[model samples]
Target: MAAGQVDELRKRVNDDWERIVELLKQKIALGSVSSKGIAADHMKRSAQFVADELIKVGVDAKVVQSTNPDGSAGAWEVIGSKIVNEQAPTVLLYAHHDVQPVPDASQWDTDPFVGTEIDGRLYGRGSADDGGGIAIHSGALQALGDDLPVNIKVFIEGEEEMGSPSFIPFIESHREEFDSDVIIVADSGNWSADIPSLTTSLRGNTTLDVTVSVLGHPVHSGQFGGPILDANTLAAMLISSLYDEHGDVIVPGVASQEVVGGLQRDLDEASVRADAAVEPTYTMAGTGSLAERLWTKPSITVIGMDVHPVEGSFNVIANQTRIRLSMRTAPGQKPQEAQQALAKYLVENAPFGAKVEVTPLDNGMGWAMDPDAEATQDALQAMKEAFGVDPVNKGEGGSIPFIPELQRIFPQAQVLVTGPEDPKANAHSPNESISLSGLRNNVIAEALLLSKLGGE
Candidate 1:
């Protein structure tokens, strides 16, 4: 197909941009925060709105009960419509309707639940991270009307912010309904506002809790200071030792590999940090591209330390302490293997004679995509056609545990991650927002992808 054909479609998408944003805001206002996500009940309502919209656009939509987790009585709906074309491969366009918890409401300028637009940007919790992308895909489907030529399926989740714990099982139980030639996870964002990116890999995550008990009771620091071990200090020292001076995770058995396309990741890191409002910290010593350091390597962070501080002039020594360790593993790494390694590391590295216990909290697998697949190329070309610019190929530092599991089960399906989100989307932060321009571009791109795939 000639690029002009795609370009025309792109123009049509641009024409409908305002309407798209309106629909997007309407969707965002529904508030579908995941478990521990920003707006739990609101998220459910937003998802229902999305289901309703999909049906209006000629897509067959239905809600699927998340059968994986017991006692979590919620449903995730699957919206789909087949493009009647023989040549194109079936593609599944995916997004999550969930938003993170909007804590510290006082810090936000506008209501986090209300979709607000200012200076050409749409501000809302889910606007950029996912709601924007979902809007784009929905807009594309709407623009195509009944002219679609390939099968397209939309898998929107309400549990992504909560690690998508229920989604993997939902996919497993409903595998037959989701059979597709390609899968597009439009949950991530671009490396920068200026650079569109095709995410190729995502790190996996594991959480561990370490509890320490030194004595039976809190003793006066001045009276019993001589002989008792300080559980807090010991815990701090053990946690501190998890990283080396070079910032490398020194845990034994936690494997490391050089990431691919490292240069882009360095750029991404700088961009991500700037957008995330991070203060400059010492850079770690690592050899390889930023992608390797981010996607292909292991990262350990002390998530939390539960310890009584010496506040209010307290002169007592606390008897127990606990810490939360969050570990992100590279793609192709086993969560159990990493968990075991962490357990062993803590056991061996702990302070002598202290009662130490390590417990695994959550284990989610890593994901790696086949970057050389045809669907990937088709999507890339479609992006170029829509934006008139080559998109960046990169990987995310965080993990979407469900992606790898989906790939493992549907090895034949092509997985692609592209979306309208950006660093400022504040996916897990306060005052989350999405760009109207970016949303327009994404809608065109998805429509172009649909066109290109249909023509094939």
Candidate 2:
């Protein structure tokens, strides 16, 4: 509200730093790994944990789940609200309680479920991905006490890591509980530990499954290899066709362009390489500024394929093969259209007339923030005050599919994306972490933003 009140809010956040970190540690230990398949016990417990914290901050919180198209109750979610004034504008704070699956905990430097702090960073599976986000919301609410100037709704999703398959249904099932004028998505990252950022754009994604077939049955490689190439080789050729000599995508109808906006600050090459752990010798893909190549332009990656394991392989000519390609589409392009272009290319350019079958796996839309919106401007200014430096507009290469869905359902809502992650967060990786500074700053920024939205 007032300058003095803002200072008091930040001081309160700093005072509660240890309490917030401890809460995050407890959340990490819950290990609510979200996927299409898993026991619901862990997720249910995770939602309760979040509800307990929000209740302490005066939110009326509860655990919920909605039925899917199959008439089955889907993933668990936590929804809460604190209405100080009904007439005041409402703000919805969003984050996920579920962490990514840890198929191999041995790869982590510490126990994947045990939150560990080292060199001012908290390391754990979901600490950066979204546990940090929960901490920010809880800590900020705790600081605001009963002085909140606006109504607030807290949404902790249980299936965000699974592309939010149950998210839209969850919101639609309880429209009144989730509706808000401003939605703050704490699921992305800052530009750096010292530089706060508001995520402004995201590249959408689509996947395809290409099946190449040559013969009806497997044949001896030594006896029938010359007549036609094996299915794996033919599949490889089709995969290669998606790229050109310089690694730029050549898929027809897929656009490749760079971001031209006020917030696009060119990235420093060395820093990005270090943060992404990109080897110096790896050939840079595409032709454009590194930032655009990552945030706006199209890129194709062979994520998976069905092939015989070298350890248990037989010397035979495979008759059929299936390959999965993950294509990152440009921000403004339609993912379904991109999927179509990819399927067409694979089907028409089959190697040696090999029978090809293309399957559309999945698709998600991208987003570009409207910088002129009142709430968007508020978030940027709040971040500047919290971090003591002007906040930068950032673009994310990854797609949070649920984001566009939120816009589709609530076109009037202003969505502002910001979070506690920095480049080194390593979210979804073995050594995931979040900087304590980012966590604290994000808490302060969110609290300030809520105050401003309430017309403080």
Which residue ranges in model 1 land beyond 4 Å of their true spot? 34-45, 64-68, 83-88, 104-106, 111-114, 145-147, 162-165, 212-229, 268-291, 312-320, 353-355
TM-score of each predicted structure versus truth: 0.87, 0.89
Q: Best candidate, TM-score-wise?
A: 2
lDDT of 1 at 8: 69
- Note the Cα lDDT for every prediction shown: 0.75, 0.87
lDDT of 1 by residue, 362-411 (tens): 88888776666677788778777666778877777887777887788889
| Error of model 2, residue 390, in angstroms | 2.2
Model 2 per-residue lDDT tens digits across residues 105-148:
88999998999999999999899889999998999888888888
Q: Which candidate leads the pack in lDDT? A: 2
**Candidate 2: where is the Cα deviation over 4 Å?**
1-5, 35-39, 101-111, 214-231, 260-263, 271-280, 307-320, 351-353
